[model samples]
Target: MKRISLFLLLSLLLGATVLYSQNPETNLRVVSVSPNAASLGTFGMIPTSNYVGQASLSIPVYEIDLDGKKFPITLSYHTDGTRVAQEATWVGLGWTLQAGGCVISVFGSNAKIYSANYYDIKGRVVKTVRSNLLGGYDITSTTYTF
Candidate 1:
């Protein structure tokens, strides 16, 4: 009976590893913002001019030490440069990356799937993010150099 129980636990553990995504720290990378958002990231700037700056890349969730213990922090996943990343502090979890007018919600302990309209410089919806899956992990973040 002991052996059977141990085997079951090990199998469950392995299954979880196979299903979970990679660690966020290992995968985060910074990239350029969408061309339109690039122009808009800066507040009070010339509205009709091209803009550029370094933004923190958003990545998926993995175990990270925010306050000593391992916790999964889902961030605003983005490949382009991050013009803004407002940290949305969870009441009992980790900080959420809340930039780019994109958002995730925690309602009565349940997380809401994020949804919003995204546009390119040409004002077209180039990307769409809406999921029945309540939790989507963060992305790998990195910076680019000229």
Candidate 2:
């Protein structure tokens, strides 16, 4: 009985490991990187002199593959050229925000807040609050990043 239980446990663990490894969505990869590309603004907000700077090459474009969907993300850099924020359009009108290496917020076409993340002082995500169609909220402890 002990041998049988151990064998079943090991088999289940191995199968779970195989399934996790084969999931493509867990592997977020950058398809391409275009340096010095045009700015797409910050989190669907219009580009201003304070955000995008004066030059056109202030933002860099990164095409990423997320769950078989391709999204072109524009990265905004600070004055020192360090990456500060990232923005990407969702579907056709919605937009997503990635700050501090984590997706912090998402907004819909009508400027509705779909999801927002709370982060710790170390810039790590603590939880995500998502709005559902039922007019309620779903809070989760999962974090997604590029």
Candidate 3:
């Protein structure tokens, strides 16, 4: 009787664990950032940045340079893709700075954002991890609904 009970308990626990980790459905989408200096060269702009993911998502980060114009950046998310995992970064300088972007991991039918960060550019002096730059914002992680 004792052996039978223990076996049953173990089996149940294993099943639950599997279901939770491999949930067939979820409503989370992750976003992320990665800065590619090559974007500058590719775009023929000396200070542009870009990020590309394994899942066909691309982000081009444009920096406001000597021209003194602040550009608006837009981001979008889609749910129909089979793979939703992504890593992104927004980077610029007069100084050096780094931060996380939105990132998502997907299971068979479920998705969750494991990490995210966003930067707001304002003011004349942007304080970064190393030095003060022309303009910058704090990096923060916020939540969203899918």
Candidate-wise lDDT, in order: 0.38, 0.37, 0.34
TM-score for each prediction? 0.17, 0.18, 0.17
- TM-score of decoy 2: 0.18
Q: Which candidate is the best by TM-score?
A: 2
The count of residue-pair clashes in candidate 1 stands at 21
Off by over 4 Å in 2: 1-46, 49-61, 66-68, 78-146
Question: In lDDT terms, how accurate is model 1?
Answer: 0.38
The worst-scoring run of ten residues by lDDT in candidate 1 lies at: 102-111
Q: What shift in Å separates residue 6 of candidate 1 from its native position after superposition? A: 1.2
Please give the TM-score that candidate 3 achieves against the real structure: 0.17
Q: Per-residue lDDT tens digits of candidate 3, residues 33-128? A: 223322222222222323432222335455444478655343322222222432232442211121222333222222222232222232233234
C-alpha lDDT of residue 61 in model 1: 59
Q: Give per-residue CA lDDT, model 2, range 1-146, as digits (tens).
A: 99999999999998886464341222223232222211223322343364556333234356778799876655443232324443323412222223324332222222323365443333344443331322332222232212
Q: In order, what is each prediction's RMSD in angstroms?
A: 23.2, 17.3, 19.2
Q: Tell me how far the alpha carbon of residue 127 in candidate 1 is from the true structure, in angstroms, after superposition.
A: 25
lDDT of 1 at 20: 47
Q: Which residue pairs collide, candidate 3? A: 31-102, 31-103, 32-88, 32-101, 32-102, 33-88, 33-89, 34-88, 34-89
The residue-level lDDT of candidate 2 at 113 comes to 32
Cα RMSD, model 2: 17.3
